[model samples]
Target: MNAAVLRQIDPGMPAHPNELDRKRIERALGSRQRYRYVSPKVSCVTGGYHIESPCCSRNIDADGGVIDVALLHHDAASATWQVFRKDHRTGAWELHGVHQRLGSVTDVLNADPERVFWQ
Candidate 1:
C-alpha cells in the first residue's frame, strides 16, 4: 500500500477498473462502496461471473459478487497487492471514478499472508 495513491483518491470510492481484478480486492485493499450489481451483458461476457481472475487472489466484489484471490508460485513470497473495478453495461453502479486499496503491511508480515480461497 502506497500513501501517494491513497492521497489522490477519496478513500470512499472503490478501486478503479481493470487494475488487477482480484477478489477480496476491495476489502483486503480497502476501498469504498455504496451498491453494485452485475449486468446481464457483463455476466454473459464473464460467463455469469461478476469478476474474472487468471490467478491472483480470492474474496468478493463490491456488489457481493464472488471474486476470489489467487497467488502465483513465483510470487508466493511477495506481499504486494492491487485491485481493479468491474464495469457493468447494465449501469448498475455508476463508474463515476476510481480509487486505491491499501492492505495492512503489518498484517501480511505478521500472518505470512496466504492466498485466500472461497469455501
Candidate 2:
C-alpha cells in the first residue's frame, strides 16, 4: 500500500459516510484474516429520519491494529458511491482519508497481484 495511492484514493476527508457506502468495503479487502465487524445502522439526530440502504463494515488487522473499511452507495449528500477506512491508531473510530469506490478498490487490490499474504 503506497502512501501516495492511499491519498489519491481518499481525497476528501469526509467526517461521516452514509450507510450504503460502508457496505461495499469487503469487496476491496478480498481475503484477509476475518474478524468480527458490525456495520451499525446510521442513527440521525432527527427523530423522524432514517437511512435505509445496504451498507457494510469489515475489519482487518493491519500493522497489529484493527482497521475498519466501510462502503456506501447513493448517499443523499454524496450522490456517488463512496468508501472509507478508519485507522485504529487514534484510540477512536476516526474515519481516515481512505475513501475509494468499489471499482477503485478492486483495481487497487488487483494492481498488487503478488501482495504478501500473512495467512
Candidate 3:
C-alpha cells in the first residue's frame, strides 16, 4: 500500500465525500458480511486484471444498494489501479475512478453501490 493513499482513522466526521467513502470502504473491505455472499472473481489480462463480484449487483444491505462494481487493470509498469462498474443498461464497464495506493482502492470500493458481493 502506498503511503499517500493509506487511510487514517480520524474517529471524527469525514472532511468530505471522498473521506466518508474511504472510511466506509475500509469497513466494508474488512467486513466478514461480504463473505456470506459470493466471492468476487478476478481475471488477468495482458496489461492488468479484471475483478467482478456478482452478488453485489442489485443487492441490498446496511451499506447501500449493491450495484455491479469491478476493478480494471490499469498500468502494469506503474502498478496503478482503476475502478469500474458494469452499466446495468448498457453492459459496459464504466470508469468509477483510479487509485494510486491500497487505501484509495478502498475508497473506490466504497464508492460502489451497495450490494451483497465481496471482492
Q: Stretches of candidate 3 above 4 Å error?
A: 1-36, 56-68, 76-79, 110-119
lDDT of 1 at 101: 20
How do these models rank on TM-score, best leading?
3, 2, 1
> Candidate 1 at residue 63, lDDT?
40
Query: For model 2, what is the alpha-carbon lDDT of residue 50?
Result: 19
Regions of model 2 farther than 4 Å from truth = 1-67, 70-74, 91-101, 109-119
Per-model CA lDDT versus the true structure: 0.28, 0.33, 0.48
lDDT of 1 at 20: 39
RMSD to the hidden true structure, all candidates: 15.4, 13.2, 11.9
Off by over 4 Å in 1: 1-78, 90-119
Ten-residue region with minimum lDDT total, candidate 3: 13-22
Summarize candidate 1's per-residue lDDT along 1-119 as a digit string, tens digits: 44337636766433322233323333342321211222111111121113233221212444454442222111112422322233333323222112122244213312332322221
Q: Write down the RMSD of candidate 3 (Cα, Å).
A: 11.9
Residues 1-119, candidate 2: write the lDDT tens digits. 64345547886633233333334433434433332243223332221111221223212343333232332233336433332333334533332223234456435433434331111
